[model samples]
Target: MAISQEISYRLERLILDGGLAPEQKIPSERQLAARLRVSRSVIREALHELQGRGVIETRHGKGSFVSTMVPGSGDLREQGPLMHLFEGHPRTLYDLLEVREQLEGQAACLAAQRATSLDRHRITKAFRALEETDPLSNARPDHGFHQAIVEASHNPILVHVLNSLKNMMLMTVQASVANLNPRAEMRKKIVLQHRQLYDAIISGRPASAQKLAMAHVRFVSKSMRDLELEGSTLIRVPVEQEAAVSHQNAQD
Candidate 1:
């Protein structure tokens, strides 16, 4: 990693570990530079990274302070039990689903062209297991299936993008499943749709796999929106609106 990245990583860790609290001021530029034994420029670069992540805020002539309730500011470094992901905004989730569909569709196409026998075996096993389990228990394994496809593509950049997308997909699925209308039978249909995607992947048909993956993602996205509309009183979506807001999940 570059020097700036190394510094940013450490500073982010400090924020995640609760060394810094919301609205609390951080060390001044010179103080930080002295403490870290780095030049002021390096400190500035690191501070900029923290700001981008929504962990800190800068005020004109007042130095930098920790931002409380910032987007993606929660402690994500520590792996724990399932974090509560309340229902996301209908439009925002819809948009994210679209982005994911575009990325994963490309990933599926690449995987079809490049996947080795071992990659095929792993994806097949994951799909088979997903088919046998309940939706709630199968969410992570379902993630594994998608992740395997990205890895099989042999493109590091695509792998990174898909890796980052996995968390939101998992959280969205969990929320959608939990908020589903039992009478509508959305969950069962969703599982079946996923099965179709898996089948297409196994067949080594890139175009078919891509199409199926897109339909499956859009299906879940629409389901979540439908649930929000029908049962708006029960779901807990965020009121704050920001274009391209981070979900604060660490899985990415």
Candidate 2:
């Protein structure tokens, strides 16, 4: 197979196998060329092929990305939802993150106020599953944990809205995760944020829960932006002092 074809195949597998999420931007051609040890022309050719196959797409200047509407992704559309419009755009996944921040923050606050013992149990279980999941596992139980939180809100409309947005959110998560090397020190920060959010919700602290949830989303959004600027799949993780402080507070 030609090198470009090979690159296309490898990237296709990343998409189909859940390594790359829909609507999530791929690394730039220069980055891909360097990573794959190929020329920029080869990377462009491979990206073009992926775009033709509907496995990925390229925005005018934003670079190429996996398609949010790929056949195997289930119920996703190229442009059916409001959120998908931002897909492959230049915002670096922030558009989707903004929607999520609004929706999920409310969900978390409501869950704090409204969750029954049983709902809390389910949410806790889901959080456990998410915690145990390998961070590199793309976006599986992460969505599950958040979905559980939404359900715990006891608001049918919020649950419905969250459910509706999940497809696009999944794509966003895939893209954000693509650049995260889970073994890095930033793992503590991720763990700290999620754990704090879970604790706040389960403890019936609506204000705390809402704040924590939004903070988590914003962190992910910023990370996506940083990854895009660097033009590489390997994202650099900075040690967050706040995360350490939060961890100690949690312990107390």
Candidate 3:
């Protein structure tokens, strides 16, 4: 194979193998050349070829980014209308959690089965970040931990789809954390559940990881439902007390 063709293949493999995520910025040509031990001209030719094939895109001032047009990936903008609808409906948060229950569970299972050494390191880093984060303000780190698991699955389609739904997922997580954080018991349970899920993944127990991940989502869903129900329950006011307060307000 030609040198430039070989270079292009290597770059493509980096993207397909999850080394370079969709929409992530690729290293500059100089960086790529140095890393690949190739001449700048060859790096430029390979990048151009990849760009022609829609594997990457370059901006005028910014360097190339991995194209979101990877196999089985779609434009996130296509879901804009549906996402707006979801944002307007409180119940959609539950729907999002339901989706998470399935996707995250499967991702955990795959991660347990397939995680490389680097993937394990990334997952461990994300887990530790979550551990050190304040429970009351852990939405981002928690999301990062889950995202790392999904990426570790090494399924490009799964990674891209979940990344596309990033906004809705974060919204759901933020809601759950915000509502459950005020309850000390619930918060502690959540932290423990996360630890269990992380342990299962790291131990390479696919079944345990899947079960723990699904259960964690279910627990969050149930807790949020309970909190919503509690908020909606009406407290009875004495009729005479209400009447007296109304009468005094009229006089005032």
Question: lDDT: which candidate is best?
Answer: 3
> What TM-score should be assigned to candidate 3?
0.57
lDDT string for model 3 (1-252, tens) is 889999999899889888999999999999989988889999999999988777899997799999886755453434344655554466776776688788888999999999999999999999999889886677668778988999999999989877655544443333556567657897789889989999999999999999999998899878777877878421212211213222110000
* Residue-by-residue lDDT tens digits, candidate 2, 1-252: 899999889889888998988788899889988988989999899889888677887898888878877856464333444544544455634665688888789989999999999999999898888778776663556667887888888899888876656544443333454355363766677778889999999889999999998888788777667766778763222222223221110000
lDDT preference between candidates 1 and 2, better one? 2
RMSD to truth, every model? 10.0, 17.5, 19.4
Query: What ranges in model 1 sit over 4 Å off?
Result: 1-90, 168-174, 178-184, 233-252
Q: Model 2: runs farther than 4 Å from truth?
A: 1-84, 169-173, 181-183, 234-252
TM-scores for every predicted model: 0.56, 0.56, 0.57
lDDT for each candidate structure: 0.69, 0.72, 0.77
lDDT of 3 at 6: 93
Q: What lDDT score is found at residue 116 in candidate 3?
A: 96
Candidate 1: Cα lDDT at 142 = 61
Global lDDT of model 2: 0.72
Q: Model 2: which residue pairs collide? A: none
Candidates ranked, most accurate by lDDT first: 3, 2, 1
